[model samples]
Target: MKKVLPFVLLLVAVVLALVFPSVEPVTVADATFDTGDTAWMLVSTALVLLMTPGLAYFYGGMVRKKNVISTMLQSLVCMGLITVLWVIFGFSLAFGEDIGGLIGNPATFFMMKGMLGNQAWPLAPTIPLVLFAMFQLKFAVITPALITGAFAERIRFNSYLIFLCLFMIVIYVPLAHATWHPEGILFQKGVLDFAGGTVVHMSAGWAALASALFLKKRTTPAHTPARVSYVILGTGLLWFGWFGFNAGSAVGAGALAATALATTTTASAAAAMAWIFFDIFRGKKPSAMGACIGAVVGLVAITPAAGFVTVPHSLVIGVVAAVISNLVVLWRTRTNIDDTLDVFPCHGVGGMVGMLLTGVFAHQNVNAGNTTGNGLFYGETKLFLTHLVALVVVSVFAFVGSYILLVITNAISPLRVSAEDEEAGLDLSQHDEEL
Candidate 1:
């Protein structure tokens, strides 16, 4: 039953996709698709998709040898599972017609019935609607994969599988719709998220914190990281893929994309340096894990502000995020909570820093997206205040929503592995495989 469960679920999803009625195609107006933009989006989608395997390696290297395969699979399986979900109804819930400002009308694009090559997505006028959906699909795939780091090696495989579907449907879809869709409540309120500072990093980070608190500490003794080299390689890939992640949000092969790419590189490099220097000041040798985590935190910090902030602003954001996340990781180590891989400190805190700083440093000269208001440093208060409110709202929603999902999944199937499974390790116990 365990072996066939995924196949069964996948078959069901396929049947549903085939049976759902395809609504009549909407008449597209005079919008013309740009071949240049379409080409860039195609490349960008592939780059974003690469991040998941990179993530698998990144998370895999941090677990014990006995759990590496399971740890990696947690990240890898999302590529398969979320794709099916997205094709069925996930995209509809995210990018379908607005529903009361909180969600999309699932019927708007049910089963991707109306998302055809001829249709142009209103949000991205220059690209094909199909390409837009595919780009967004990559983002959906990676969000839940990020949460797996918090509970790594100790979660039941079946429970994690169940939680993945629930998280995407109940948490991610609404948040994405609310923040990115044109009529979304936050979007209407003039919130500025160039990429997914609030939708992706913040949601994943807060949920990770909740997972750690709910799961409690691991029963088994801690082990050293299985492979630092793998961590470094994964970091390199994530760094590479992030260019596509942030820049691609422009939805066009234009100057904005170029600016975003530049800022991403600067921020990541700045954060990596800051982390290593901070570690050295603490009397510890420079560590590969620290550098990788710091780089990723920087990437998270710049995601929301990539298009609106200048290159110099990105440097400051990276330095600040690195220091703050490093401190939080240190603080967390002293507490009873075992967050396995510090997902919350690095992603959650880093995302908050980015959102707030974007409110402070945003400049209209940098990009045309800042039509609403600039940051606090630019003598404007509205954007900063709005970001603060958003931070509170999103944090509460992600934490509370995720906790409820965890509880529900636990009720259906125990979330934690048995003590015997823990001793034997997740790779062998859960999947009957060993590294």
Candidate 2:
């Protein structure tokens, strides 16, 4: 059944891709598309897609060998399921015309009806509407995948499948619309989220925390990571792909992309260093796991401020996120919250650090589109205050909404595996496979 399910999903995806070609029936007049920008977006889409596999390795390495395949599959399945959903209506609900400023109007681009060829997306005016949709698809694909690290090795596969769909429809899409759409309530309020600090990381982070709490602690308290090397490799891939994740948000081959690329690079490097140093301070050896986690936290922290802040500013963002996440991980061990891999500390807390710091250091000079006003450093209070409000709103929405979805998913089918299956591990019990 597992093998057949994947194959059927793939077949549906192939058909969707073939049916939705690079041609549109209706074209907008005077909508100019640039070849250079199109070429850049093509690469960016592929790069963003690579992050999912990178995430699989990241989460896979952190679990026991008995559950590695299941851990990785949790990340991989989203690529298929979310792609099908996005093409059908996820894109429309996220980026289609506004509906009361909360979500995209479903009728605007249902089934991707109007997105292709010469049609230009208002967000990325220089790129094809289809390309923009595909690019955004990558973002939607990875957000839910990030939450799997929280409840790894214990979740029922079928219940998770259902939860993934609900999370996207009820949580992710609305957050994306409210933050990214020009007419979005948050966007109109002058909140500046250059690349999903609020929309992606914050939402996923809080949900991860909620999921961990709802699932309760693992029956066993201690478990070992299967492979540290895999963690290192995953970190490298995530770091590489993040260039596209952050810079690609520019949606053009322009100066903004370049600045974002520089900031992303520096932030990760600085965070990695800060993380290892913190370990040294705690009288622990500088471990590869710590390094990788630090680097990823840095990447998460800089995501929101990548385009709005300068490269040097990213150094502070990275270091701060690493130090704070390190502290949270320490605090977590003292509590009963079994966030298996510290997903909340690394992503949720790191994202908050980045979002708030963006309010502190963001500069209009970095990008000429400075309508959001300057950060605290520039003596402007509006942008900083607005980010605070957004942080609170997104956190509440994600935590509460995710809890409800889990309740619904549990009602349909138990969310946790049976005690016997969990004891045997998800790889063998859920999928009849092992590495």
Cα lDDT tens digits, model 2, 263-337, are 999999999999999999999999999999999999999999999999889999999999999999999999999
Worst 10-residue lDDT window, candidate 1: 21-30
TM-score between candidate 1 and the true structure: 0.97
lDDT of 1 by residue, 1-435 (tens): 655877898888878866875656655786688999999999999999999999999999998898899999999999988998898888999989899988988777677787654688887988888789999999999999999999997999888999999999988999999999989999988889998999999999999999999999999646799998888989999999998899999999999999999999999999999999999999999988999998999999999999999999899999999999999999999998789998999999999999999999998888876767878998999999999999999999999999999999899889999889988999999999977
Clashes in model 2: which pairs? none
**CA lDDT of every candidate:** 0.91, 0.91
| Sliding window of 10 residues with minimal summed lDDT for model 2 | 1-10
